[model samples]
Target: MSAPTPQPTALTLHQASRVLEVGFDDGAVFRIPFELMRVYSPSAEVQGHGPGQETLQTGKRDVGISQIELVGHYAVQPSFTDGHDTGLFTWGLLYKLGSEQAELWSRYEQRLAEAGVTRDTPMPAKTGGACASH
Candidate 1:
């Protein structure tokens, strides 16, 4: 039989540290940064409609979470200070983000370099079918 996915045992929001601390029943704890969460949001607004259509997030070094609303029993929806609140972070997603932070950060930096921009660079105005206002 397949093993059941780990469920969250605790969740804490550290506003000052700008991280969400999540503990799982499987004895794993993750402190996911707000900036990282915003940059890697799974929303269509950030992820776009398909592969190669991701909207690179920049100038989010200080992004903050204003609120986090629990969704049913499976996820949490965070409202960012930048006005982004569409991404529903499932337990699995959060766990992945926490476990892969180092690699994700390296990839983010590489993408920034490839785009000829730095992390501090302000994001350009978004324009497209799904994101016409940003």
Candidate 2:
């Protein structure tokens, strides 16, 4: 017989730390950062309608999770501080994300490099004096 599906036993969002901690029934636990979750959201806005249309997310280094609402027994919908609340994070997808985080993060970084985008927003150049009229 097949093993029973694993479900999250505990889910905690650390607002100050910007991390989501998930404990599963199968004894697996994950601490996922909010920025990573935002960038890797499973929403169509980020994933697109099909393959080869994935949008690379950037400048989300300080993104935070605003709330998490249970979507029946199968998924949890997370609302981000940036007003993104479309993605329904299924148990399977969450598990996969936790398990393959390292590889996925590496690929994301590579994609950002290729797109010339940084996870951090660029700071404005500082000027010593006030701007002059043109």
Candidate 3:
């Protein structure tokens, strides 16, 4: 039989530290930063509809999770302080983010450098797109 999916045993939000701490039944614990979550949100708004369409998030170093709601039994939807509330962070995605934190940071930094922007640079005004509110 196929192995069952890993499940989270505990989930805690440290608002002050801006981190999401997740503990799995397998004894794996990950402390994922809120900034990272915002930058790498799994929503279409950020990921876009296809490859090469991803919107690089900027000035998100201070982003915070305003609220988080459980989605059924497999994920949690977080509402970010920057008015982004569309990404549904699944257990698998969360685990991956936590485990690959360093690599992800490196990639994000590289992308920023390529775009001639810095982590502190504010994103330019969003042009017409799926959501006018962004």
Q: Name the best candidate (by TM-score).
A: 3
Give the distance in Å from residue 81's predicted Cα in candidate 3 to where it truly belongs: 0.5
lDDT (10s digit) by residue, model 2, range 12-129? 9999899888899999999888888888899877797779877677778888887899999999999998788999898887887788899989998898789777778542344553
Candidate 2: segments with Cα more than 4 A from true spot: 1-4, 121-134
Best by lDDT: 3
State the local distance difference test value for candidate 2: 0.83
Task: Estimate, for each residue in 3-48, the C-alpha lDDT of model 1 and write its tens digit.
Answer: 7768999999999999999999999999999999999999988898
- Whichever of 2 and 3 has more lDDT, that candidate is 3
Clashing residue pairs in candidate 1 (N, C-alpha, C atoms within 3 angstroms) = none
lDDT of each: 0.92, 0.83, 0.93
Q: What is the lDDT of candidate 3?
A: 0.93
Model 3 residue pairs with clashes: none
Give, for candidate 2, the lowest lDDT window spanning 10 residues: 123-132
- After best superposition, candidate 1 residue 44: deviation in angstroms? 0.4
